[model samples]
Target: MNSPHNPLDADTLRRLQEDVIDSYDEELELEVDDRILDGPAGLSDEARESRRVYFRELFRLQGELVKGGAIKRITQRLNPRVCRVAALPAPNDREKTQWYFQRFVSHLPAAGEIVLFDRSWYNRAGVERVMGFCSDEDLEEFFRSVPEFEKMLVRSGIRVIKYWFSISDEEQSARFLARINDPLKQWKLSPMDLESRRRWEDYTRAKEVMLERTHIPEAPWWVVQAVDKKRARLNCMHHLLAQFDYHEVEHQPVHLPPRERHEDYIRNPVPADMFVPDIY
Candidate 1:
């Protein structure tokens, strides 16, 4: 059997090493919480000790999570063709006037294509309902309509897979705190996220209702225990793969063609003034 291709040249290998270090550094930056590391003011001795233990475990978990080049390797090897859409909350005008399901129809994948929604029409069932963005009647209608809408999609030869990442309140709080503390991650926290944190119970109740109401045979909701970020990602990927009986397609081996040189052809040198200063 032919050996697999080593695509990385010396320069590429060096860049890959730098990328791995960068990834580890980013993970470390997020996991290092100042409150826990510095020992927060006015904390009891027992609380300080608890915080230290928590930080240690958190660091260990994060270490396990940050696998250098794992994501890049996986994506390169198992490069499944997929279209991703961020189905965020509708604008104020659309929320007031547009039908919720109408907007999603355009985003439906073509035949043999997989479209992964970052969020979906289920916004009405979760955030919109909990945040009072949708009226009670509108929320009730959404609960009534969604199962049928999904059923229709399934009937139309579209396979629907749904996942709900379940995180504990404590874990979420810690994540929020981490994001707030880390400048790089602070952008992830929105006013809506803070409000969601305050109305956690409401969101929980909404989730329960959504699952109970919309868990259909065609597209059942799969809940991933997402407190452990690494585990949740792995489990979700595994489960998603298991949903389809997919196999690798055989392909003809590729051969690189040699470039023909022309003696008459001469390359022009780029002007030194046109080059940007290499600050790095």
Candidate 2:
């Protein structure tokens, strides 16, 4: 028996609850990626041996951000989600005709939410310019307008922190070769990536111009030397945390309530065939 005002039925509510629990579980597994997540308050001897201090600090920063501390955490180094992969796909005919920044506007974070862009609108200055996807006029206009647009975003209470993860040619080459050899990483190799590698000089020129023209006081760029991925992650996270003034949240202690019980209730089990075989 559901009320008309309650839009979510029991089944729908159950599914939503399950989805949230599953997502939390998945987020927790990232702790294994950097063992420092166990306790940000203390750096154990094991953490020191594993060089987990960097990761621990990163997780701590993220926790502070979650607690409404004046911080925003965006992890990028070696993490594709922090880079170009998070950007929108190629513009369709209609999108191209609209305002250049229209598509990106929707992705902007609201108050207190930290929106991390893998590759931002600067794609026009970087990839699009180098790949000849945009005209010379388009490139010039983007360079001219981006500073003003960023200033507007900043004025609107948005913190526009830009980062350019710079890695060497030799390092990139080695990474590409490693990916080619590893079956697990084969999906990372795309025709566009291969083409980009060939046009390295063009990209370098575009990057230089983009940085020079769009580097405004309101939204300055921070270049991260990303030859060593781990160091880059640590350095970037540390820098971001330093830029903010954050304090730990004071929370009250929690007590678990006892579960309700019904003496007449009985639990039922499904048939053995309903279970999946555990080969492992």
User: Candidate 2 regions off by >4 Å?
Assistant: 1-86
Scored by Cα lDDT, where does model 1 land?
0.67
Model 2 per-residue lDDT at 77: 26
Whole-model lDDT values for every prediction: 0.67, 0.69
Look at candidate 2 and give me any clashing residue pairs. 83-118
The TM-scores of all predictions, comma-separated, are 0.71, 0.75
lDDT digits (tens) for residues 100-197 of candidate 1: 78877887988766566767888889988988888999999998889899999999999998889899997787566556544666798999999999
Best prediction by TM-score: 2
The regions of model 1 sitting more than 4 angstroms off are 1-81, 92-96
Candidate 2 local lDDT, 252-274, one digit each (tens): 99999999999999989889999
